[model samples]
Target: MEGFLEGIWHPLIDNEKCTNCGFCYNYCPKGVFEKNNQNIIVKNPADCVDGCHGCEWKCPGNAISFPKPITKEYVIKVIRWSKAKGRNVSKDFIKYALKNQIIQQDEVSKEMRD
Candidate 1:
């Protein structure tokens, strides 16, 4: 699942609300945010952790936001597609999705069967 979900989920910064604070840049462990001269920008959005919202939570101006919430249907679609493409879905990703309630336990098998 290394590059499977890349560029799918990422943060969007509201420039009006952003104060050019570097908190998000420093807080993001994935280097998703970077300081560009006077402003902080989303440099490598693909590197953002799927369920992690540390940058959004740490933003002092509340400028960060995701495009949409992850849904169970979406996860199932991804799983099915991955299987069709002969990609090995990561067990850790499945566990994380299950633990986070992004996909229900029973629904995984049901979706996979399709």
Candidate 2:
């Protein structure tokens, strides 16, 4: 649970496409999403918990998708956190983050608008 492992992966989101409705955030079982300035962000990307594809399946804008595979250690940490919190993470939620690439874009936009 400290290094990378094979078969581990996460979703990438497109912030431009996200409506910030919190659909992925609220639906995520592992608390993988967060809201900032009416946009969705990946607050707990390393805590995806489970590879469940619920978020990808539910996104209306198709703003979610899987990115480069992650390490098993990272995946374990994600799953461990979700279980400790009594929940399971969703793949769709991560997809929103991946498809939108929220992390870098959100920060850039936030700084510009400020």
Candidate 3:
């Protein structure tokens, strides 16, 4: 999951439901969220990374969204890396990823061949 992961993702706050709790601000390892005027804020959107959802889970107010989903090309790259590393991954794993919407079917074939 290193080197390259696709898609844009960041934590989004539900302001109304939010208790203005600073739990997310304190829990995030990347400091993506911060306490501003006693409210949680997305201080550094770019600092946020995909698949890192600690803040979302830690929020007592349940006021965060973990970015958009990843694309299929990204999944294929992961598959490729796993295969290249001789990991014991299933051949049908890619198909499962596509079916589950964990990855979209864009450029899957081309990337798989590489």
TM-score, every prediction = 0.57, 0.51, 0.56
Clashes of 1: 0
Sort the predicted structures by lDDT, highest score first: 1, 3, 2
Worst 10-residue lDDT window, candidate 3: 1-10
- Provide the lDDT at 64 for model 1: 90
Q: For each candidate, what is the lDDT?
A: 0.79, 0.62, 0.67
- Predicted structure 2, TM vs. truth: 0.51
Model 1 Cα lDDT, one tens digit per residue, 18-88: 99968998888899888999999999988887645567767899899888666786678678877887876
For model 3, the stretches where C-alpha displacement exceeds 4 angstroms are 1-7, 69-114
lDDT of 2: 0.62
Using lDDT, give the best candidate's number.
1
In terms of TM-score, the best-performing candidate is: 1
Ranking by TM-score: 1, 3, 2
> On residues 22-80, what C-alpha lDDT tens digit does candidate 2 reach at each position?
88988988788888778888877777644556787788888887675444444445545
